[model samples]
Target chain A: MNTNSDYPKRICSTTGFPICRSAEFFVKANAVLGVVFLLIGGIAAILIALTRWQAVHLLPVDWFYRILTLHGINMLIFWILFFEVAILYFVSTTLLKVRLASRLTAWISLVMMFVGAVMVDVTILLGKADVMLSSYLPLLAHPAFYLGIILVAVGTLIAVGNYFATLYIAKKEKTYEGSVPLVVFGATAAAIIAVVTLLHGAVVMVPTFLYSLHLCPQPDPQWYRLLWWGLGHMSQQVNVCAMVAVWYLLAAITTGAKPLNEAVCRSAFVLYILFINLASAHHLLVDPGVSAGWKIWNTSYAMYLAVLASMMHGFTVPASVEVAMRGKGYVRGLFGWLTNAPWRNPGFSAFFLSLLIFGFIGGITGVTLGTQQINIIAHNTLRIPGHFHATVVGGTTLAFMGLTYYVVPLLWRREYILKPLCRLQPYLFGIGILIMSFGMSFAGSMGVSRRSWDIDAGGSIYGPTAHLFLALVGIGGTVAFIALFLYVGLTVGTLLFGRRIAAGKSMEDWGTPKVLSTSPGHDHVAPAPGFAGGATVAEAHPTQGTMVLAVIFLLSFAVYYFANWKALADVWPVR
Target chain B: MNQESSSGLECPKPGWFQAPSGNERTWIGMAVIWCLILSVMMPYWHFRGKQNSTGEAYRVKPADFVKRVEAFVKVNTGEESLVEDGIAPVVPAPPGEVYLLAKQFFWFPVLKLRSGETYRLHISSADVQHGFSLLPMNMNFQIVPGYDHVLTIKPQAPGTYHIVCNEFCGIGHQQMVGKIIVE
Candidate 1:
């Protein structure tokens, strides 16, 4: 039952609460890195948005394309990856009430990832590659770009290994009892996907890298396309899982409420695990080479189940929110509780707005565009980015920001800096994102293509309508940039300079209580009296090595599938 | 006068003079408003009309056009001096099927009709990459560019439907418009 011993020794000195040095260090390190990534990505998003504005036509064609490519990748890929890594760290340690299994491995992973990210940006800046982020095959990039990506994938693999090791150690030491907590389970699933996805990245990129250096002939486009999807689709699923996990985490932190029905939450995660992979074919719906029947089966029919799962969660989470608010005695219409809810609370506000924005734009467009009839019109257009921003920025990024407000302070044992600003940041960013998404959708409807260098060339296909929409998009980008800057400033300041708060006082004492402790042996663990849930601590925690190994095996399968299929055409014949 | 007096004598029964309850009146008002709105929007449903084409509908077929193109190509190629004339030389459509070329921004079609009609026209790109939109008037279909999208326009109207690429090719994308005149 002495979970405290597993955590670093916390001396209750002048601080009036136990402060674990290791927890504090990890929390602070994550905050700093989170801020840096947010700043870079936010600036890039703003620049891209502003270019759409009327005032800035100054950049030349090639320069503009390069900048836009960097901006898109940075905001979409880099920002999300940075936040997910930090979340992985937090979920493994804080949620499970255990320290990281290996600090050295974690640090090494961070350094390697940082190096890889920098190399990519530098290569992009040097104009060595402008594959426009998607980098579809036949279009090649500089060797540095591929190498950078490989390093990043390897770094993530290492981090996943460390997380699994920590979980194994926790089970060995017997931290808790019975079924893994929902949030941890979801994170573990995401990490499993991440490993599989990254391994695919290695498989695809290693050959591509060699080919670029003339050590091998170019890989066939069809082969590259299929292999890339393994990475692309699976990484997206990781985001999906992580986003959902944050939703549950936020609910616990904000209202001191767990999912009203645990089965629903678990079922949603299960649905994602089973159905998300097949849904990746939606991206290939308009592609010429794929068969009509295969597209229908993989993209359309397969996606419907995942869509249903999302809708289920969409309804369930809000219903839980409503119930929690209703319990607080806001007796009004179904929507009245929303109006009466505390807007000042950053966690509540961000979670609420992010959920709304993502579901309406991201979720709707995703479903519509995934359909065969619609994908023909929407693919490779501005619509693609519009759909993703709705999901990634509005969904995952917002959730990460909201979570940081709690986790940073909780881990660091410091009060949030600029409390008012923290509350304002989410709304500003959320509104800005909504505006940007709307503009992009309008442009797409007008048939504005994505990844274009010059939309207004002499013989260009786009007309005045495209120009107008791009301008509006620029305005939205500017607003988002400012909001993100504010967020980074607030988050970083809170971690380092915010007024310190007492530690023993749970997150609720600061404002609202969002976390739940179901793990036994911890003092704050949820109690189930009279032996119904009681068990020996050792029996409570099961070794997680099997789960970890299972994930690694899945990754290996994906890698082998890609490599073998590319090398030998007949190895995995199409039916 | 008697009728008026009889009607009025029922004491103009001040029908529940109290103002209607807010909730009840609101519900009634909402219902009326919804009904009115639905009625106005209903007419749009039939705007496309009922002139539906069934799968069994008779229309022009591709085989007839192929024969016409082959005859033209054979006759034109036989006379070597025909190519030297100032008149535009006629080229045959490929042996088996229709061949349309879609380039950086243009759709070019070579058409030969069953009635010994030969028409060759140039489709140029206006803005970005656009598909040559070929739709049979009164038929339920469209053909996009970049793929081998061929159609036997019967020259029914002997006019153009204006081929525009649905894909957003670039800035002039909207302006990249082409016309198909079948004669």
Candidate 2:
């Protein structure tokens, strides 16, 4: 062990990952804050879902938009970003075996972020900022709302700055080798996206704040929408990058999985940093004043690279797991690897569920809905929320929740409370999200409004079909809400009162995460077979199982894409 | 204490950036094909699809468009009616470049169009931005002020179609409904 802990730290016994005092404090603080926001946002999500369900229109028109704004900020921005910051710190410091770049700046950023979040929520709850998540132009909110957003953006920028600096320091100190590990590279992609996204927030919000203060002219709505989505939709892409990174990380941590090829994984990350945020223009597909060429280039040509990157991940992640399982003596048939996966572990289950939902539901629907002509149908409808719920909620949120289980024991040095409930958490949540996503998408296809409080629109009559599917939305929301409730409760309980882990349990028995290489079959001899009692995995496993799964995924994607096109064609006869 | 061997079974030497395996190349090739397919699908849909744009827009102030809409309502051959929600009075228009306005809470100058006859529908917002969402049909677009969105539509089979503002314009956004009576 590199017992060079003059900087107030100790090497973790179980995982061999370092536990720097400053890094641990920041990680715990941000993580706790992340959970706090998740609880609030998850509650708000249930309320919003219920309200959208016509049979039980839970909130009034005003409260619906209000809670929605809070939900959007809290879940998408606060919860995800805070947790990602922690992840960044962990990947930079512990994984690379280096100290955080600067502890003071990280603390300040956290405080600023917390204060900003509180301020934004306060404004929303006071009903002074019910402009929905988009908060479109000419419809002004309190200045604090924009300022709050700006502060969070600035704080996040500072954190990203720290991440880069930490990397530089790690390189200077000669920590690890050969391109900084796949997970760190993924986090780096996310951080790069964050820089671009946050700058947009600053550009738009600063002027908006000034406008609210009567220090500037009323900003153009079209211009605001353009700049705003650079932050709005792109921020979610940042989450996508981080979320996929977490998938790789958790798979490694839990199942001893590594990418089938590290170079491929790194290349995918590169593609993401280059082209993922281009898909943000899908938000502008329906808006006038923006040229078709711009929208087409963005939504079609450039954005496809990001989708391709995700596709690479979709294959490699599970392939990693399958290869890992096969190496561990599950090398029977094609699916023996899959059958032997650690479904009982919350960490493993969450990663798997995240992959499935993201690929099957989120990825397919996103590409279809993101198409230029197709956006006309899905853009402002409940379909928009439906698609995102599957991606950000089902994919990113679940991945984070799954990761929390490992984080608790690993960083907090605490064993999980309610072990049985922890195991059930991912499956139950996954099921809930599936139902919720279906209901929302179905209701959306029927033309249920996205931000509307009343599907009936003062008894305008969208027919019982709308009501029926919306009721499905209701039932699904209820299921998902219950599952979310359990998650929040279990997580909070585990954090506050979980038992301490045994000594000498750094990451030894923690699923033996072999994330360093992804060589195929089982030529792996651990470099020196008997050095650390490491077993040599000796059977050559065929990777055809993952290939089959990939084909199935592609078929599902094609079917959904064609179905939307058919729907679009049916809307009007050819000119 | 944990050993360094666990991070990787076959740990790459300190600068291993490339994967010699062929699986990665196959994956990359597949990704490139997908990109090309997605790229081509859009223009194909744009030209070959029924959902193609009318290539229509002309800048106009919100006030000027409202006046133009009002003038269209005056000269058009259609009965004056209220949209389904009975919220806003809609003056149905004839089959020219029909002017329409979307504001905080409602859409104006709803159209009464002939079945299977293409009508140029010009929609703009008086304030902020609103959505011109035709339900059941599920055709929708944004209504940005100072910019006109001209959609050419031929409603098949005569029926009353409700237009809901799907965008978040304001608190009364849900109540912003307009109707098109296809005759």
Candidate 3:
């Protein structure tokens, strides 16, 4: 161990990963702030949900728009990005066993992020910015709103720079041997995407900020939408990359799973780095100032190479888990490994559940809705939110929560306060988000608009189907809100009051994680002898069940994709 | 203390960079094919299918677009009975070009159209960016302040379709609804 006591680095007693003390402090700070913003966003979510429900229409018109804008920023930008910064720090310094590149830059980034987040919240509450998250041109918000977002973006860019710098130092000092671990590589991919996303934010937001101050002429509306989604949707692509990284990390820590093929996994991440940003075009598919050819080519990501990346991860992640589970002697049927695997461990359950939600619901709907022609049926509707809620909330956020379960125990050296609630939390949250996403998609299919304070404002009744789905949105939102509250309450309570893990001891409530290369007991989980990479390994450990699941996912994608086209055909002829 | 070998926490033991075989390879190939299919479907629809966003747009000032809509409304407004409160004129659009303008809280000049005839429907926002979302049928497009987004369309059924501004403009976004009467 590189026992650099002067720089405050120590090895974790539990997971045996090196813990850079300064990095750990920033991780805790950013995560705590992330949770705080989640609470704020969650409150906004419930209010917006109730108001959209129509029967229980909660907030007044102005408050609805204000809180809607608040919800968009707090949840989408603040909560997710803050947590991502924490992940970047953790993955880089800890995974590579090095000190944080610079504690000063980390602190500067954190303070700027926090201050900017506050400025944004205050400005929105003061009724200065009513433009929605997109904040398309000519619907100007206060200059402070744009400045606040720019600050947050610049801060995130600094953190990403710190991450890269840490990687540089790790390589120079020879912290670890050979290629970086898969998780570190994945984080590198996310950081790369973040750089691109933040640059787009600077390009669009700086001018918009000036325009809000009446200092520059308005950026063209179409031009603004084009550049803004480069920041907006591409940021979600960053989340996808980071979430997949966590999936791999949690899989290894919880189940001793290793990548079946490192080359495949790394190349998939490369696909994301290369082709994912092109997907920003999907947002403008139905809008003007872009041609059909441009929309199709760009929305497809030059033939969906990035989606192929997601599909690759979707299979490899679970197949590795299956191999690990089957090696534990659960090899009965196609799914016996899945059935007998760790369902109780919060980390294991959250990771697996996030995989299912992200792959089955989120990934399927996203590709279908992002189709250039299909977007005509779904653009700016509740379906758009429906698709992303699956990816962002159900997939990314749930995966983060799962990782947090282990992070708290492993990093903070603390046991959970309520063990039972921790186990129940993932299912509750996953199911709630699933229900909510369905409601949004179905209601949207019935011509219900998103971002509206009231759907029935014009006395145009949308019959019973739309009403029923909106009710589902309300019910699902309520369930998710409750689950979110429980998660926050449990997390905070555990941090404050949970028992400390004494040194040289494993987590008692959650079993000691089975480390893959260390334990003689898990020797069976290792790849076949000599790493010969073929039919021998495939025969020894079967992923027939994952193959089955993948088939089901593909089928679902086909049905949903063609169904949207069918629906588009039923509408009036337009070109 | 447990002396742990850095398995996951470190780089994989050397020679871990192996190609995916069997089920994993098959899935990758299938995914690539599905992606190709997804890519092909869009351009196929653009050429062969009726429902496509041609995205035919022209840059016009907000005031210019509003004036064009007013002129179009003035030319078309004749003998059409009031739909409801008559806050907006119920203009009968001929079988050529129709202009619809979206502003803060309302869409101007409720349009009356005939079924089974193509109209080059030009939509633009008078001020901020808004959405030209025709409900029930649920065909939607963007209404930008300076860009006239034209959708060439023919309504198939005779009914009153509500046009709502799905894009967030301001506090009164929910009340921004107009009607398109198809006869």
Candidate 4:
């Protein structure tokens, strides 16, 4: 393939990562949009949290709902998708060592997505679209609201097409030999799920868009919910896939950790593509007109396959890190690898934090809550948000944030502006999210309603503990908000005015290592500067610490799972 | 860990479909067992577990269901609630199935039931989708229009449990609250 001669290309001296002008444009464009949405959402989060806080009760009812709508749409939908779109461009171009395919199409999609996101935000801010993120039908919003979502989804679909085309181009041009990199494979899964999810968006939103115009009859609420979750819940699965992909990418990039087994990891990604979206049916388990067999089938056995995929990831990621650590001969005890793991590196720390919270909080809670009978107590409570916030905000968002640390210095050619603050950011954010999610989950278990602007409703009862937990949510949310502001401020400051790198290439010190081509030898540390971060022990074994962590995770899962059942049994004692 | 760092990258390819290592197989086996156990729990609970959410279903028009609930409430408007305002008085309904109409902002009437009586409670939404969440007890189900969900439940303890609409219906959705008083 001939270079267009118009597009600039360069390889980074520090990381050896390729930078294509066209791909960089897409990355910067989408990433900036993601940040913009984050800012809007973060502000809205504070207001909503304050309102939900019983003592303060900041925003009025309508404003509370309106702000909550903006918060959900901006953070969950717009911000994450925009960032993932950016990731797709990066994967197809820089990772594959190929120029981005179809620059014009990418630009068009970017513009359309931006316009749609703006349109949705404007509709919500104007107080005409407070139907919450679901915007359940018969509760009409402005026609523009539906149109905005449709445009965003359609735009994302187009971008996904461009991603596939780029992959095809990579293959045709013989960018690399045999299978693509693990990062690329995982990204491929995410893109595949994204296309399917966007289609579901079209399936529901098109009719609702038309209904808003009085051009079509309203679909049955049950039917709408069935289809709509294919969009709503499945879209988050895209994030899950992306987050996992990024996890692998970060592990390799930061720690030089080889995936413990490429085949198993790839199989896990394949499983996500095949069965993850079906987990959406768990949302409808309590719904009437849906059969028991359907609910049980979807939630119980089939969805477990997806859960298996998540479990595989939960194992392989940390195990891979352990392999890397043990390769450097850190095997002193069961936790030697963990002890030697990079704590100061924000890139590593954030990813590690994400993995922990996502599994313990999100994964265990998700499986427990998704259970057919167990959903009766958990569904439509704050636990729903609690579960997803762990997955999305704590897991995926943290990963993305971590990835950005490398992107700024390596891709943007600017050193991170506030390194000390950057190191502390993830811990602060992770702690805040921890408190918020647990507080919400415990409160929800106490029967606090979700999506209700007020918990202290007329005729509905709540215990004293519920108010305390709500207060915790408010405080945690405030802390998270401040952390988010710091992140955005630092990120923006870095891009604009951070020190420009002057070819400060090192003596094979800390930079991008070569992509591993063989199964790792646990005893031999690679002769790389960052690879041997003070190897402390003699006898080398991989993932000993990880195995212990896995055991702990399993025990926690068992305790939480049976505890829910115990709670259920307490309601109706079986003799 | 790969050797080349800081410059000139080599796009290396490893054994793509390598067999699972020892730890990998062990974890996979554990996962399989855990998954099967969870699945078994579902069937076991559905068969013998008393907290099974799956129950009877019936179809009813919103017009008729609302009328039945209104009549039931009219007859049983004897014991006023001390805890909350605007609540219609509660009294025990006779055996068999009873009606609960879910509309814009409330359930039609407070259901008063005996603690051990297994009454088939028929619930339906009058307008859109609502949720009948029995709080404190932590029992919930979707109330959909045109589909009456008949739940055969025996309230375990004699107490007042709030029935709140957990699903988002509309602007006044936050206010939709009812009560289930078990005597």
Candidate 5:
């Protein structure tokens, strides 16, 4: 075993797949995509908000719906997808101390997904379809849109396959023993959910495409409804799982903190697995035909479990933060660390603020709207967007941004270009979201419907209030847009122009260097019996075991896809 | 080598309802001041709990609504045509009574009067995504249309709750909202 002083300061000697190289590529890819998608989506959201405020219908019916659809799909879906892929790369390589299964396959997946995304954008812009992001049945878009969606799904499936393959290879090589690293285990769960959700997407989209081409009479609305939700709701569950994993990773990076109780964090993830699928029924609370008992079971009681998971994380993560801060001697009062802690630490500040915003706005709305009776009133208004923005944008997006600051620098072995600007972005974005969310809620309460072209409906009494609130929403949206733009600029500038570190210095060594010799916990502990003993032998051999597992998983997909195709063919004959 | 224990000293408690120290205190003070201003301006808020044009108050008693729903369902469902028509056959509202349901997407009312008299409809959702809309009357209320709770309206002048599903509900969501016509 190598002594602490003899630990390698450079890349691992096993292969060309060093952690820094892997992290650098992944982080750069994510940052570029993250900034680009945010700009496109943010600008669209701002335009919509501004038009609503001025009481001018700048977006035609087609343009309005298209913007809304792309705004959500790009930011909430594409941005998260790219970030999760990058995070997966970092986790598998850096945390698990392994290389990717195949760099070629990873690049292929990225190219296909990018192609699919471009197709979706082009289709939406051409006015061939404006079905909105939900893409509810009976509202048809061009066939290209459906094909684009399929390609994206296929790309993600390939990526998931690569992830498992990489894991199998690592385990065979015995890089780590017994259980997987917590972060990778969490990501594996997300990948599993993604596979199931995407399969459901094929079930919905393949038929919808055929129907649009006059191949079938029409897809059954009820069937379409169920299938779409299986995709929609499950994808969201993937987001939740990934977001939680990021929180743990951020904690590790920022303060070298781990969850006080690993069991609690693991259980939180387990609860999400059990409950997220059932909670999709909350979206259908006001819908007809579903049994009242079914709705109650799924929407009300079942969702509370998922809610519990979120709440637990909300408490536990902050507690970990508190403990870490206290270790740093910021011990004034119970909540004093919150004030005395380094607000300039972009990773720390963003995660904390994101958690706060999500809990207060998103959590409250989620529970309230899940009620069977209450859903009747709140089903499809702007309030729906407001609630999700709190959860998805304020929660997931902010976490990703926070993680990026540390992950990018560490991966690339470079310093941030504008470190101070990075610190300021979170506050600006958080405040803007607060104003926008509050104004939206107020407008919704006053009965201002969502997705409408005009706030003034002739003689409606609430017209003036709606107009005013929409204006406030525009102002808030503009602030958020500016803040996001600044973030993108800073991140990209850092990657392209920031100072490169010396080859010999580790990333951890360069930044605010901790004195390893004098620190209380600096002593190197020997690895337990099984992991270190097995590593050398396992690394020397090429095993066919991982190949078999990959074959099994791939076969399952092929079979599912064929079965789905057969079902569609039976419903609508090719002739 | 005994060290002094920091845990033994009792932390000073701030007064009940008083702000804490530092930046937090300023935030609290601002919140309190805003509350005071709102309370003073409450009289001019104008729309808070005002009675509808039919001289009936907007708020409905939960117990009364339960009793009324029970009575209406029992009497109306007794007839085959009411079931066939897919409308809530009208029953009787107690003199000057209103029935309200807080829904996520749209309002559902079982008007409990058999008499052909018009009443005011003031509807709302508690959280997000609501429509107090009666499609037949060409009326809509976008509640929390952007971010908050929303309330909608329909006057008894129309005689029936023209259940219109205003928002896009995945697929079957449109079929959820139904109506009550006073016979």
Candidate 6:
């Protein structure tokens, strides 16, 4: 298999992973297109942010809605899913030491996805599909819009099929010994979720598309929402799984981290695969036609097991990092490992910041807002976007950016052009997103609507405080867009003009930290394989700093969750 | 734990399963408890909390819902001066049934009610789906075109509450605001 010319595999000079040429091409192709869509979406973000800022009110009403539609699809679906497809390819072939199952399938899927994306963008820009991302039924969009989405979903499904095929081949041919790596396991979780999400897309979109063409009766809007969010919100869960995988991969790359306990980590991923799709219920919490029992049961994901999974991942990810850093002899205090972490490495900084923002802000607000009663205060407001921007943009996008910092030199064989700017990119993006999300949440708390072109357009004025928060949205969005521009520009420029790595030479280091001990066994204290049956007590080097942080996170979650309930209580008495 | 090769890229040794220990174990325990608490809160709120989306709704056509809303407005209207938005009627009603219709561009009828009295508000969209986002209070609910969503509400504060169409219904979604006056 290694010597087979048809597959044509090469060893990654830096990471030493096997990178099949066909798989590598697909990864690069998807990533490049992903960045292209990100550019489109980023442009839309600044424009929409300016318009939402009453002081600017940049675009007219129609264009505002139109560009807003484009932004949602491009950012949420195109940018994220395209990159995820790339990740699926990378994890399957690269991590598992196998060739892509079929290059023809990969190419066909990419082409379909590309064409579909273009069609959707054209339909939105032409004002044929002013229906926002959800494309909720009864608010019909052009038939082309539905068809475009169908194409993308089908293409993604094919790509996922290819991923599975590769995985099966890896196992059948004995490409590597034992079970797949933890990162590959996580990617498998994401792929499984994507399959469910895309199937939901088909179930909901096909009928809606037919209805748009006047071939079928209008699908019930309630039913549309119920199924559509299975695609919409469940798709975001795919992003969560992928982002966590990237967190692990980046941690390993940057800090030489390994999973503290493979069983715990793998079990967490299993929870995601089993229960994360139930999270789509959160979107339909306040909607009519869904009963309280149904909403409560689904929204909690059966005793919040999915959330417990997230908390476990959140702990294990950084705990892995803390242990790894401590192994490198940064164990001065409970906080020394964190303080001495590789802040200069954009990969480390971006990964760490994404974890913080996602857990503290996104995860907290999401759980609170998804509470059946609390949705009354949050549904269809800026708070909804506020929560997602932290999760999708801050968490997923930032982590992907961190991966690219290593991926470029490793895959594209090009060094990053601007070193200082590369270092600053994550902080810029993270702070911008933080400010923007906070502004959105606060402004939404004051009843600033999500998709409203003007809050006072109907002659009902939101006070100065709401307007001030809107200003924060504009300011933060501008900064984030600038950072996005910087990242895209650096990536593009590096590919075109940055110094190329000599063939067969190890890639240049991206500022990894110096370790006190060159040895591995002493610092990374774990029960050896011989005692795997029962040596739980033998695992030493406690992640005390991470524990402190976890407690802080839990405390923050409580404060925010309780505060939202209190706010809900203060609202008009309703049943 | 499983041993790794020098490259750190290979799969772990075959039997890699192990229980979480030390801080990891503690965090998992605490997180599980928190999740349980979170799960308990929603149903608890349904039983005891003031605000709960009972999801009391029935299937209805857009036209039927519109006709019902108009009939409610006509029966409740007492003063001509209450009509402030040209076509929109400001209907003051006693504690009982009330109707509010959400369309592409506006919420029909300016609803007026007394504070400290409960009203069964029947909300439905006349055309596409719109959000029934009662402002200042920040309470929101979905208004599907073919459903009569009933919210039994009692206003505690005396003020004019704005109903902003938070859902993207159409081009004029921002201009789609209705008023609820509690006196």
TM-score of each: 0.71, 0.93, 0.96, 0.93, 0.69, 0.96
Tens-place lDDT per residue, model 2, A16-71, is 66677788889889988998998899889889888888888999888999999999
Top candidate on lDDT is: 6
Q: lDDT value for candidate 2?
A: 0.79
Q: Mind giving the per-residue lDDT tens digits that candidate 1 earns over A1-575?
A: 64546467454332233443664465456546656766776766665666555447645556666776677666655666666777777666655556678778878887887788789889988998766665654557899988887887788788789889878866776654444566887788788878878877888889999988989997755457667777876787788788888887776557643343444455667777776777657666544345545655566435356655565556546655554454454435435446666677888888877787777778767765664434544556677788888898888888888887877666666778767778888999888888888878778666565555444442444557767778777777677778888888776787679887675554433355333333443323222232221011112222122123223433443353233223222111111
Q: Compare candidates 1 and 2 on TM-score and give the better one.
A: 2
Tens-digit per-residue lDDT, A326-363, candidate 3: 76666668897787778888898889999999988898
Model 3 CAPRI quality: medium
- Candidate 6: segments with Cα more than 4 A from true spot: A1-6, A517-538, B1-9, B81-93
Sorted by DockQ (best first), the order is 6, 3, 2, 4, 5, 1
User: Between the candidate structures 4 and 5, which one is better when assessed by DockQ?
Assistant: 4
Q: Per-residue lDDT tens digits of candidate 4, residues B1-183?
A: 344221102233433355676676788889988988888888788888887666356677778878877776677666554435566555646556677888898877766778777777778878878888887877778788878888777777898778888888877777888877777
The best candidate by DockQ is 6
TM-score of 3: 0.96
Q: Give the higher-TM-score candidate: 3 or 4.
A: 3
Off by over 4 Å in 2: A1-5, A301-303, A502-540, A573-575, B1-15, B19-24, B77-95
> Which docking class does model 2 fall in?
acceptable
Model 4 complex DockQ against the native? 0.42
Local distance difference test, each candidate: 0.57, 0.79, 0.86, 0.80, 0.57, 0.88
**lDDT by residue for model 1 over B85-110, one digit each (tens)?**
23333444433233333333444343
Each candidate's B-chain TM-score, in sequence, is 0.32, 0.81, 0.90, 0.81, 0.38, 0.91
Chain B alone, TM-score, model 4: 0.81
Question: Distance (Å) between predicted and true CA of A464, model 6?
Answer: 0.2
Q: If both were scored by TM-score, which would come out higher, candidate 1 or candidate 5? A: 1
Q: What is the number of backbone collisions in each predicted candidate, taken in the order shown?
A: 22, 6, 0, 1, 50, 0
Give the per-residue lDDT of model 4 (tens digit) for A1-575.
53332447787786566678888888888998999999999999989888877888998788888888999999899999999999999877887778888889998899889899989999998988978898876677899999999889999999999999988877887776667777888888999999999998998999998888989998777778888899988899999999998898888777767666667888899999998778768888887777766888888638388888889989988887776666656655788667667777788889999999999999999999999888888888898888988999999999999988887777677888878899899999999999889889988898887877887766437877899999999999989988899999999998899888777552122233223343544345444433311121111245667778888999999999999998988774311
**Model 6 chain A: lowest-lDDT 10 consecutive positions:** A529-538
